[model samples]
Target chain A: MADLATFDVQSMNRVDLVTVSGRIDSSNAGQFDEILKGIVGKGRNNIVLEMNGVSYMSSAGLRALVSTLRTCKRNRGDLRLAAPSERVVDVLKLAGLNSMFSSYPDSVAAVGSF
Target chain B: MSQVEAVFPARFAEIARICALVQLEAAAAGFDEKEQFRLQLACDEACTNIIEHAYGGENRGNIRVLIRQRDGSFLIQLHDTGRPFDPSNFELESSRQPSADLAELQEGGWGLHFMHSIMDEVRFDFDMDQGNTLTMIKVHP
Candidate 1:
């Protein structure tokens, strides 16, 4: 299995910002999870997942997000979502996860939420 | 046996693009939009599970995807050398149940359930001899 894709994490103020682009599926979902784990490990609890460029997501991707949220909650931090494409948003809604995390139209608003 | 194989790193961005390709191929092969969507969803779930669970948090393996038309259905097989867990043995909870809390409905545990729900048949075979294989079928409706 080759590296499926890459993700970038940035920090702004108290927010741990993550920008994920590429397919999040069985092949790379674990890597995505590990990226999130690294962020959580830094003790920066307020998270904003910026998905404006994410073209697709699978249940595995959703799982990574959920797991990250759980981790943040355990640390008394919060995870927020931003700028998911229509297709990505549909999956979240279909899985009934739209309301599980706070979603903003873009990263600025998402980061501002904290 | 004519087959097509797509190889990509263990990343989410590529999964989305490949899923679109798979959906297009399924539709061109005469699957209705609804059926195509179902196949796409199932494939996405399977592939995503492999990415997250198989490689154990790294993009360091291959997810070999094979698709063929057989009998009156499209047969899809995903081959991965990840962990040896079987998806077939897992009990899929219903998606229709209303949850008392939003956290209970978070997105992590639905990959197997979604694949099982959408595909006509889903099977998993773990072979130390050959690796892990997940085979699924979707028939034209």
Candidate 2:
């Protein structure tokens, strides 16, 4: 079975922090989506996605991020990305998503942006 | 130099990892790193769509991927025994529009559009007896 590795979610300074490891593609993209939905469901809008441990991401992963961003905006919240690997950054740039979201060098910076 | 094949789950996560391998190998074959990443994103979108929509969310079938080099180009074929669906039927969204508005963006519906925009050539073959096959090609430019 193709697994999406693991994802850890926490809260800090009123920002919902999500840390994703491993790969995010078709199989596990939905799981990530559900996790984001759950967090948004709790009405926590300020969000930071930390991708330092992520080795790979597909367009499906990008889709999940976009979805989360949309949900945050709908609820008057914001989403930021932090510390993506070079490979992950490359995909974001190719998709032109790098410019669409606020990106910080680390989780602390990202959280502080809130 | 030659051809390679890998089979993985019809799940989204596995497809992403396999596509990453394809990008790495394609980059090593002299393709520009940017183009390589585009190919990886396109492949991931296509394969993930298959696993989700075509496979009926079963998540337990085999997805066969074939990578070959031909005529100074790289060819990838993805084969799955899922429901028959043609990717060519839908009109793809243009990549020219910036994803600026989070309200205008979508999560699931954009996969097909993303795949079509990045690949140089994409085609679909449906075999009632065999399965659905997606063939994509990227020429080194």
Taking every candidate in turn, the Cα RMSD to the unseen true structure, in Å, is 5.4, 3.1
Q: How high a TM-score does candidate 1 get? A: 0.66
Clashes of 2: 5
Residue A3 accuracy (lDDT) in model 1: 24
Chain B TM-score by candidate, in order shown = 0.83, 0.84
Provide the lowest-lDDT 10-residue window in model 2 chain B: B87-96
Model 2 Cα lDDT, one tens digit per residue, A49-73: 9999876677767877888888898
User: Tens-digit lDDT track for model 1 on A74-99?
Assistant: 88898998988765786676676677
Please report how far candidate 2 places residue B128 from its true position, in Å.
3.7
- Whole-model Cα lDDT per candidate? 0.75, 0.77
DockQ each: 0.23, 0.43
Query: B1-141, model 1: which lDDT tens digit per residue?
Result: 335778767665556655776777787678876566668778877776777777775476888888887667788888888888654445544334435464565544676767766777888889997778989987756
lDDT of 2 by residue, B1-141 (tens): 778898887775476567767877797778876677677777877776786778877575989999887778888899999889855454544344555765665554566666666777878899999998989888767
